[model samples]
Target: MSYETYAELKQLVLPHLQPIGTNYREAISGEQKLVLTLRCLATGSSFASMTVPFHMSNTSIARHVLATCEVLWKVLQPTEMPIPNEDKWKSLAKRFGDLWDYPFAIGSLDGKHVALVNPMNSESLFYNYKGYPSIVLLALSDADSCFTLVDCGQYGRVSDAGVFQASRISQLLDQERLIIPDESFMVSTTEKRIPFQVVGDEAFPLKKNLMKPYAARTLDTIKRIYNYRHCRARRPVECTFGILAKKFEIFQRPMRLQPDRAITVTNACTILHNFIRRRDGHMIDRTSEINYEIRPNNEQGLMNLRPQQGGRNSDEATEIRDLIAAFFNDPRGSVMWQDQNVFRNVLLLED
Candidate 1:
């Protein structure tokens, strides 16, 4: 982060992080606390390692880092990452249509596994299929690679679909309280209107407002086109994850703190990611060379769950997918290079 950005953040959280001094000794300044926390997050160093440079004991460093992380989340979340309402949802959908050529997409959704030291007595509760303890970081990101909503600290044992199913957004969606814009035609010429939607990978269940690509084994030209375009639209969230991991090296290794503190630290990192982006403008040039698809060793099995059994998608959802696929295949909606791009891959796969 730039000095100007850091100063701005320090000002925002200073009131909450400020400490009271006693007659016995002077309290640590909020600026110092913020610096300490940022250093820890940036390097992923152990609290003991921070003591030599910061001139504090290991316990004091840990306490300040945790407290500052909590304060950062409390202060930054409202301003940096507010929940999107109807108009905001529409704005996101418009960006997706304009930038990615996928009409009516509000966001791209995904899950990431943050490695953690096993909590005492938790047994397999925190243990995931990847053979380690972790907490899930489920996120929904916008077209500009900014997080729109996040649910942290889910048990790693859960699948991406399960984590999403249990999120507050899912509850609001099910209860019809999410305030999505009304359905509209994909283009002026299309007869059927479709609901605004979020795109995810195959681990997610298909719904009227949530789309996943067609089964890879069953791909034809049109389905392949739809999948290709859908992947394009869905790339933002993946990019955001890559940028987050790159910015906060804390996520590069298993966090040594307990689950709750780890969650707080994760939350703080996400808020800061948006705060920095909003201040620094789009990071496309810096992030373009990043391999967004790379996963940490702990996250290799994040979405390995089999497709949900015995649960059929509603016909309406199927119809929406088909309509969108047809739209992509139609000249009015098709991009010129999509056929060339998809067919080359098809030929390679056949070989």
Candidate 2:
């Protein structure tokens, strides 16, 4: 986290985080408590690990961290993830097109596994495919790498699509009550048009308003180009996770707290991550992140749980993806250097 961000967060939560008594022997000062919490978050250290340096017992350290996190979550979640008006959706689309070369994209969708110990008596509930106990932190981030929506604390055993199907955000999108704009944008200077949409990897199901890349190892030129553009558009969410783990460090190591406490810690860090990105525009480039790989296609089969919808929705989704792919090849819809850049990179890889 940036120094300015740390200072701002500390200033906002300090008063609420303070103990009531004026007596030093009775309780620690707000400044000391805040410092202790920040240290744990920055280093992902256990409470017992912090006892020697902070001179506080492990119990006190845990208390301070959880209490501070609760206060921050209540104060910041509303402002950071407020429902978007029509103008806000349009603004997001404009930013996506201008910055990411993907027109009509509202945000990038992805999930990260935050490692933790297995919960007691829960048989394989939190165990992910990678043979680890964890929780999934799913988020939709805009072009600036700020989280527009976050749904954390889902079972790590579930795939990204399953997590989304179970999330309240999916309910909102399904009901068309998410305050999305109704306006359509031109995908081509001609008659081709599309509604603003979110882009994700093939882990997510395709919908009229949500896009995923074509799922195949063998791809034609246009499909590969479309996949390239779609992947680039989805990079921000991955970068957001990278930046969060890099700054908080807790995500780099398995969490030792109870499941509930682990949720609180992850939630607090998420809000703080957005706050810093909104305040300082800090985004880590993640092009070279070796651990970041697409989730296996077999793992993301989550449509059975979704509500039965009319076939028109599926048809429209295919039509939308086709229009976008055609738009990517059109002179008016295409970026001048996009084809050359993609081709050059492909050649470099082949060598």
Clashing pairs in 1: none
**Per-prediction RMSD in angstroms?**
8.4, 7.8
Q: Rate the local accuracy (lDDT) of all candidates.
A: 0.83, 0.79
Off by over 4 Å in 2: 1-4, 22-24, 189-192, 282-313, 345-351
TM-score of each: 0.90, 0.87
**Candidate 1 minimal-lDDT segment of 10 residues:** 286-295
Residue 303 displacement (Å), model 1: 29
Report the poorest 10 consecutive residues by lDDT, candidate 2.
288-297
TM-score of 2: 0.87
Off by over 4 Å in 1: 186-189, 283-310, 348-351
Q: Estimate, for each residue in 68-171, the C-alpha lDDT of model 2 and write its tens digit.
A: 88887888888887777777887787677767878668889998888997677778999999999888888889888888888888998999889998987788
